[model samples]
Target: MPGLDIREIVRAANDRWNAAFNSGDAAAVAALYTSDGTVLPPDHAVVKGTAAIADFWAGFISAGVKDHDIELLDAQDGGDMAYSSGKWWATGLGEDGKALRFEGTIVTIFRRQPDGSWKTCLHTWN
Candidate 1:
């Protein structure tokens, strides 16, 4: 962690996130998080734990959400914890069977693992 760059964390997490979410595999997306990770989706109740988090993302996938993208704006690390803020977008099919795009900003917190990798511990978007 001496020369640890936040971008490394960003890349590691974001790459897997985009792949899993876009493929509509909610469980894989949840696996990117820590065991007790939490997601605070805007306007929804607080979601904690990987099981609940998988269900949370499953709802979106089931609703036809796809093409998730994250544009990392900034990130910083303090000790074993780090966070990034960025813009995100996704496409979902509406009731009319037309594509609906949603864009927003998100902040994600990560914790360093023993193997020197990073896992998302917290995430929130609006």
Candidate 2:
């Protein structure tokens, strides 16, 4: 069995992410990650560090991105490491009149930080 439950972590992370993105607060979203965290975007190279992560997400914020109705597909826990897959749709002017649907997967390696918060040490996406 996994050492820590990942469902709650994923829920919290997604909540913060959705809130930050909808509010166009890139910095706040980035703050959810560790200082040396890693984010792998679909069309771009790996983004390392919190500053770079913020920069990478800047486009979405500037384009008025909106995420809604996130349906969690699966969650697998492996001690301090876990992954989740889900389907989400974003509807906004940036995506035209059509909603942008994505079958996304996120694998996160969690680290027990000094402050006792489970921070993402590494993250990869499809």
Instruction: Indicate which candidate wins on lDDT.
Output: 1
List the pairs of residues colliding in candidate 2: none
TM-score of each: 0.93, 0.75
**Mind giving the per-residue lDDT tens digits that candidate 1 earns over 1-126?**
457578876866898999999998999999999998999998899999999999999999998888999999999988689999999999988889888999999999999899888899999999
Question: Model 2, residue 116: displacement in angstroms?
Answer: 2.3
CA lDDT scores, all candidates in order: 0.91, 0.69
Model 2, position 6: C-alpha lDDT score: 70
Candidate 1 stretches greater than 4 Å from native: 1-4
Q: Which stretches of candidate 2 lie over 4 Å from their true place?
A: 1-4, 94-103
- Model 2 TM-score relative to the real fold: 0.75
lDDT (Cα, tens digit) per residue for candidate 2, span 1-126: 134467777767667777887777888878878899898777888899989988877877676566643556676666555666666656556335565544455556666566556666676666
- Candidate 2, position 58, lDDT: 85
